[model samples]
Target chain A: MSDYKLDYLDQLESESIHIMREVAGQFERPALLFSGGKDSIVLVHLALKAFRPGKFPFPLVHIDTGHNFKEALEYRDNLAEEIGERLIVRNVEDTIKLKHLAEPKGKFASRNALQTYTLLDTIEEFKFDACIGGARRDEEKARAKERIFSVRDEFGQWNPKLQRPELWSIYNGKIDKGENVRVFPISNWTELDIWNYIKRENIKLPSIYFAHKREVIEHEGQFVAMSKFVLIEPTDKISVRKVRYRTVGDMTCTAAVESNATKIDDIINEIIATKTSERGETRIDDQVSEAAMEDRKKNGYF
Target chain B: MDILRFITAGSVDDGKSTLIGRLLYDSKSIMIDHLEAIERQTKNRDDGEIDLALLTDGLRAEREQGITIDVAYKYFSTPKRKFIIADAPGHIQYTRNMVTGASNSELIIILVDARHGVIEQTRRHSIIASLLNIPHVVVAVNKMDLVEYSEEVYNNILKDYDSLAGQLGLKNVTYIPISALNGDNIVDASQLLPWYKGDTLLNYLENVSLADDINLTNARFPVQYVIRPQTEQLHDYRGYAGKVISGIYKVGDAVTILPSGESSRISMIELGGKKVKEAFAPQSVVIHLRHDVDVSRGDVIVKDEDIPLIEQQIEVLLCWMDNKPLIAGNKYLLQINSSRVRCVVKTIDYKLNVNTLEKDLSPDKAGLNDIIRATIKTAQPIAYDSYQKLRVNGGAILIDETSNVTVGACMIQ
Candidate 1:
């Protein structure tokens, strides 16, 4: 309803809002996954717009890897406090110690994969029937095959061979006890689209996303932030340079690119000529194998 | 940028995946890191030349098994337009997956191997594109290099596919001959084919006119959920929230709630919390009515004059998806738009041979990937338009209630 039909971004926003409202209406207990990333930040804005004046029917779930950047954690806390919603954070650190899981060793090791255990544990503890995520098909090959209302089994596993046929906008959220749906409201959005939207909507993100001088070291052909979680090897080269992260995650794996994109518009422009993919260049974990993402998704490692 | 959604379907070894990969590559959409990853993967699998086919097959099983088992969505953009590509499996057993991809596409790309010319998969995909009411069709004569880029081979494919396209009622058919592997006439015009004068696949996709594809004559909106925020500032608010599937709706229009046959004026038109004067097709809106007429979810609203048929029994063309055979007298949960009803299959008129377009009139059952015509009886009357007339309002899916699996896709005939 407007003077003219919605352009691409508005249409995408409207569609995303419709999806969030659907998830809120259909699922008995749902939570929005907050990673302090740009996509999840937009998701929070959309969910608020979908149901405002009244508190959201669900809480915000953040699976804390505990290896996060300080700025990202600060932003997550501030956004949750400003919105006045419940933020339930379960840590991978706790899960690793309690479950007696071995931490990934060496310089390139990331707590990213270990997050799945804590995430699944949180879902089971709260019996959350649906967990909303900011995953987009454009992010990876395996994500492209995901349905909006993706179903996970009792063991928190995804069966890609038996995915249900989703027709039009009708999402069937029907699942039995012990099973939950991992809903993605922005499944169709591309990285460029997300950046363009963040610029247009003036959506805020963590300071790490914009360029600034940071202490970093080279790892697997990319510049990664120097952190306590990452054991700096004797052979590694340390440097202080102006850089920004395309994707923010655990500092051990998420790499930073040399950039002076101090603002959202600058970031959007930088993406236009970006030669490397975010998950490919930054997410060293997904680059473990060609089917690394597929294996992770199948093993409930979203 | 304008959005274009298209589907690519063809059997294995027909270069369907290779064509999609070519589009992504030549458009400069594939990033360097992704290319390196694929390069490493190709070495591991000894795929020879950095196999582009591996890029589109998403699942680990699909990669290990070397086949596409389900539909996967891909996104890319040129400076001119944005594209959403639905890559569907082409095996005969995965017709339901093809249908799922075609259900939302405005155009369909059916790749035909140049050596094979017009084959069974070519005909089946063409029929599916036509049945799904996809406006545009592209018959890409792929692997032209294997055929030595022969003009005669391309022309013969055009001639063979012309009759099939005519038979299937595919009005907007375009033929392009190209080698997806060597990157000919996909994103770049081919120097290999000097005799051909046609837009590259990427150029055509960006330039295609799809504004007129929407069904604007029949206004239909099925309420998915009711938005009622009972709060202090805005104490009274009752809005029927749904997407406008077709046509246009405006404030103060004489809209009627279907099944109940109650009439009311549209008091306001709300899109994403703001009141607007009018709303058009495909935009999600929360509409307010002048009177409270006992409206609820599953009630479709339309212009009072443009009423669709309200009936209990519907004849549908169904593509069975589940392993269990679809036989007459089996019950299912029938869902169309936002409406759901308990329904039973009344009778199977005939089973379809998708490859031959033949009908078996005396078929007792239809199993996985079988397309058949059957009559379905709903527990209550439902309002719908014919599939050919209005796709969004007409098409539905049959879900197995107990298992919560979507077993069949139905197009009301």
Candidate 2:
């Protein structure tokens, strides 16, 4: 309009904020699914802008896998306190203890899938009509086909066939009584865009995202950060590696890439030069099968 | 970097996915790991040669069926500009998906198979592209290698598309001849067709003149949220937050709030918390008016001299997306630019045959994927411009009252 076109980040921000407002206006009871990940961090930041001077319209819901990093949990609590918004935490451990769900055993065991049960339970418990997420299309293959207002049925199952056609900037946030919608405001953003935005905004994140000297173990050709959940075995070699996570999920399944990118700028440059896809390179949880995400999504996994 | 959004549409075998695959491949957007995965998927497939389409057939069902069912967005970048390509499905019933992709696109790439020339699907896609007000259209004559890269075959398809473009009133049309499979004339110059002189698809996409696509002459800003920083230190801060749909807004500009007829002057414009000199279309900014007008979400702020049409009834070319037939007198929640109102289908002007471009005057019903000209009466006045005049403020979507699903897409006539 003014001869100066909006840069990619600015465009992405505008679109995402517009989406956030749409969700806020359309849904009566909406909650943001915050995992304290980079994506969720951005989503929360956007909510602040979407309703600045006014508190967030909805609470921040976190489906705790009980395998999250200590730093992530700390950051999540501090952020919620600082914003003075309600943070609802539903733990997978509760479901496991109640015998409704069982934790996987043996090698490469992850609680990522179990979180879906807790998530669905939380949604029903809170009667949330819409759950906002920071999922990006560039992250996964199935995500590329997901609508911005992804609808889930009574059991929170996502049907690929029944997806409503999202046209223009108009989103249909309508849902039945038991059914809820998953709104992905950043559906069009890429990993590069996220990093650039984080750098531009100077947003603080969990320390694990940056390079640090940490005790780690090599599993399946990946340098994984050693946490309490990670069981050390004879075959697994434990050593200190200067690395940072490309994505944050369960501690057992999330892998870290070798880098010295302690600053946001270095991470941005590292992502640009990296050849592997962001989620593809890490997150062994999605490697269960070719359609792992699709299968998991059908069962209400984000 | 600026980004260009485009949609690719044609028949199933027009190699739309392969074309996208080739563009990503030649642009060095595909990584080595993804290449290895594609190679693995190619081993069991009939096409032993690395099937590029596998990369875009994202859903498992789509890959199993070997057809794209929904729009799968792909991103790639060159030195000049970043690209967001929406690979729309080609099925006749998937017209809603095609329209969804084309709604926000600045350009549409319609692949016309060289052997088949301009077919029914080409016209169908072209009509939808034009209906959605896509500014640019590129008729890519694909599969040139199948037709032996004949100049006559390419010319014939171009000639057919030119006439169709004329009939469809496609203002900006570009013709290119290439083979998405052989990577000819995609990025690098192809030596096979020396007689054809034109810029390659990648080059043209990189250098296209999109400087004037957005509407800037008309000022339209729909307030999305009201920001009142009630902090003790910065108390009494009231800002109207929204993305500028069109035109420009500067401090001290004369503006009027619609629906209330309240007038005010811009006191300040803030971008990301910092006060910016000015804001333009598509940029999200928070504005503080000099006077506290009765402004809320869905209220539009516009220049006093250039106001949009505010009326209870609007004529629109509606594209139905639901399985339920759209019947006259049925009510829906019409949402446009943050404004939502109850609306009813007053009349079905005509159920136009999208493929044949024939108007059915005796229309009885409109079902899924049906694009028809109709009149919608809203509960209150809606501020809008003709879609041809300003798409950002002129388009709307219809939601079913019970299901809460988007049932129709409307472009005001």
Candidate 3:
């Protein structure tokens, strides 16, 4: 055995597990925000380790944008069934029609921002006082300043200027009837840490994360996958390339990077040598400015 | 590798943010896009120079106001180690933010403007660092370039800081003179101050030993959950899962479960899905016992020889952090480790004046952002050591049951 201790990862894991237990003990109604991504998958596995002798006290929730990849959706349902937990899904298309969220302009116009309306509606519909997300702070600049237990106002809006002081492991999850808290157990984790952890734990992820041949078209300097939700321009020409998604999001905006990292080890080595960030490669929304994530977070987008 | 978590505290215009920016920049931990964004924003400024402080000032309000409003964390790494830097606000009103940042930090870097020497904020940060029991402290005298790199100026600041450190009972104090704006003696050694000899900031950070920071003599294990794999192959397996708070525990060691007084021997210690011969402090592992006792969450396991005191009344220094004043007779949940019990504030002994280091005995109410010495009576007996003995078990948080908000952090006397 290596005498060197993995203290950093150990500390991160302990803190996350402690937060998970606190969620179970404190909240009257709590749910995990599962998206069939690597972060959420690690969260599910941690929840299982947190309450192994008994079933999970809280259910798993997924806000479906209605433009998700088929493999990702299938993976979500299968994982929920395997873990034997209740999976609650709220569709954005229903919210667009009933809640009058926004007009479905074109096939390519993003409902990504509209999913916030659906998510807040679901939180109110289920009376969930705490919603657990898998957002890591190292992913974005705005996320770097977030508290582990981030409080939201009655409208689910985050005021960055006014936030409670979180000291030690004590989390203040206090809110009124309409107000709620967003809990991020993996807030301190980095992108590289998540990848290394997944490799170590042998956690299964969707096939889209690995390199495969797919027909894609270039839009605004990003290789957008050609899907039913994508509106291909008349002059745009599609080409086949071996690519993999650095992050999973709405098919219209999420892009893929050219790679041949088919296995987990290869992906880890690729990430170590890659120059661009994960969000830079896949998230089209962040290309506008530096504070895009902060703006979205203030408007109650997870 | 061992993790070293540290915090930076100083007054405004002390180049606190600049030092952090230089550390990140020199370590090459920042991404190209982030650097490019900072570069683009720098060009927009009238100075036409890259403002290193802009890298840490993330909020729009902070950028517009040109002041830090809250604590912002920055992560970076070198080949030798990984660091989590907590950049705390320096304003007097944000004292609570400084305390929150220094609570979990192993080291504290107090920046002092060489021209201004020792000021009120310098004393405030030094006292807070000592009060929080930070193991190491680095007093970086910044802006030496403006002072012509004078040794007399550096010595004067050192003399004033020594008096403050003496009053606060701080033993480990290291001073280094540098100009954070010009990047002198921060990441690289300075040729200007060759008369003064010491390790550079980066070198000290990489070489500072933290093995002794943890409490390895006193064993503490707070049970977080019970792990049992109810499968055919592992049908009779039962493990108590928790993070080791302090000390080292080995298989076949004699242990005592708190509140129950049940004695047993550890059967096995498993970490990261593998069995281990021994487990030490700060490691999260699942411990199996030889006997299946009635142990659940909130139970603590300790070495038999070093049993904690079981009592219903305790004295503590409480840092109140709510908008409402603390009412003496009101009951709140006092959580220590994983165990929580109803506690009533018996009396507010005194409040510490942050600047004078004196106690105000006439203050009957502990208001918001006040640090007071108080005694509390618990509904049930809790097992605990002294704050200096076991940090995990000796500290607690006061929760308002009605609001479910953590209102105060308490350290046992």
Candidate 4:
């Protein structure tokens, strides 16, 4: 009798697949916002499980910040090519140049804010009615309040106060023209759940997730990887450390944790033993303010 | 391990957030950095005790006002089960939030401050739990330490709530006395309340019987998308992709597609892109029919032996969510499962007074957070079971076409 009962991971997978299918059924011009992160990698896997045997209903869209890690960019291109799906790449660098956007000047000058411009422009370019993202509610506080089918206004601004009451499994994807919905299929999953599901499904991720020796500079206590995107000052303490990324964001803002967890099991064990939240340890952009994510979300950033 | 999704119902002062915080903290789900952040916020307080309530206040407005205005999802896990807590604000004005949270939950924990037991909010929360047809109910009598863990007080509250539960037809009710502030009877059994012989809250939650909650007798599968490869290799393949909302599906079983009444045999079932003989409830799978039927999205595939009710007019106990008042004869979109159709509010019958369990027989209009019984006429027939029978198929939502907002949640009667 217990055989009929699904494993928790299986349940999560089913729920996510259901959501992905809902997006496919509801919207006309939809796109999956792939970031080449483990979460997005899982999204692609779920999308395959959702609409495969048939070609994907929508294309894989990536708003490349240009400051992205080389390995992630290569992995993104390969995954799309291997899956035989359409890939749409919009550059934040081009958006910055075309829109005459002033780049933020700092030691770790993140193009995170500028990425929204490219994303909105791409949404306008393709007129994507629904954009599926890999955002999990467990990632941050503001994210916890977001609906599964989050509606964004004409400018892609997220009004947290005006969110629709998402009831049951019934999602209201009905929106007017110029208004888009951001569908997060993995909203219920947590960071640990993501890792566990990845391990269970045996999904492939970029090599940065595994432990590797890399040159990093210590800022506060977090190890920021030495990339051309960041400004390396003389006062910075540089060292070669065995580090891995807990989360994959732009190289300028995402920090690495010192670890020897090369295997998935070891990584899971380390996550269980760690005391810091995923954002607290890796996302330098979130450290600017307590409401940083909230502000970013309000400003049309995914 | 399985997952338990539950809702905690209480007001700002009910220590609802504190209880959730205690659950996460004791279960080792709260990380050190999150705790440190809370500590930083708790620094200026004269009491010196960390306000666990601060943990769930996510939005800036919520943090500044010190009130939860929206439903916030919090996760924690013990070795036994993973729990998703939908921490909803319990004020009367936030009934929409609670209804939204309760829609997906199998269990609801109605918090009762020991000092004030069986209050209006308690009854209101219970009414919602009953209306939503939540499978399990845990009446957590919190603030036991403040009440001196008195057996008489707990008994009195239980007596009062029992009659209310009876009136509301709430089944599977369990009671526990605890103090969220002192962490009594939350994760560990309370040393203070020795008179209570029932299992602690966490113990009961970890072992609750959720197997029966899934309706296996009646199979329901609503197609969300149609898969057609249209390639040289599998050019003839056509599949109906959907989640089995309930029951089981097997190869060679007779099936009927609703609204079209097209009958076909299940020739094949695919689970996770692999061929499978059978699939059960809550599983996402693609079903291939032996015959090519005219099937598309918004179609329900069901067994011939267990046909659901198909009707255009439905009586619904609706929770008006939007600020705009719901007037009789106004048009909206009624969506049941994957199927949606134009619906009109034929009549706003009566508003249910959540606090008193009394119905206002002549309510003119339904406003925000107001629960009312109404007759809705849809443009097309909807196949569904009663809300009390199968929650998966019985629940629906009313979408406002002009604003494109989900304005009402309808529990189809």
Which prediction has the highest DockQ against the true structure?
Answer: 4
TM-score of each: 0.95, 0.96, 0.92, 0.99
Sorted into a CAPRI-style docking class, model 4 comes out as high
Of 2 and 4, the candidate ranking higher by DockQ: 4
**Share of native interface contacts recovered by each model:** 0.57, 0.70, 0.43, 0.88
lDDT tens per residue, model 1, B1-413: 67888999886598887888888888889988778777877886654787887667677787678777789999888887889999998888789899999998889999999999888888888878887888899989999999888999999999999999888878889988889889999988989999899998888998988777776779998886677768777777887877788889999999889888899999998876678998887787888899978888789999988999999999999989899999899999998877889999999999989998999999999999899999999998999998888888889999898899999988898
List clashing residue pairs in candidate 3: none
Tens-place lDDT per residue, model 1, A1-302, is 23345578877877787788777667889989999988899899887767654567789999999899889999999999998999999999999999999999977788888899999999999999999999999999789898989999977788888789987677888889999999999998899899988888788889999999999897656899888988877888999989999998888888999999998888888898888887876787887777788888888977
Whose TM-score is higher: candidate 2's or candidate 3's? Answer: 2
lDDT of candidate 3 at residue B35, scale 0 to 100: 75
Off by over 4 Å in 2: A1-3, A82-84, B45-47, B64-67, B229-235
- lDDT by residue (tens digit), candidate 4, B227-264: 99999999899999999999999999999999888899
Error of 4 at A171 (Å): 0.7
lDDT of 3 by residue, B1-413 (tens): 44678999986589988899888877776677677778987887887878887778677767778777677778876667768888888877777788888887889999999999999889888878877778899999999999999999999999999999998988689999988888888889999999888988988988898777877788988886676668777789888887788888999999999888999999999775578999887777788899878788778898898888888999998888788899677689988877888999989999988777899997779887688889899998888887655666787888888876778888788
Of the two candidates 1 and 2, the one with more favorable lDDT, higher being better, is 2
Best by lDDT: 4
Could you tell me the TM-score of candidate 4? 0.99
User: What C-alpha lDDT, on a 0 to 100 scale, does residue B49 get in candidate 2?
Assistant: 85
List DockQ for all candidates: 0.60, 0.65, 0.44, 0.89
- Judged by DockQ cut-offs, the docking class of candidate 1 is medium
Deviation of model 2 at B204, angstroms: 1.3
**True-vs-predicted CA distance for residue B361, candidate 1, Å:** 0.6
Ordered list by DockQ, greatest first: 4, 2, 1, 3
Candidate 3 residue lDDT tens string, A159-238: 88777778766666767788888999998777877887888778999999999999999776678899888877798878
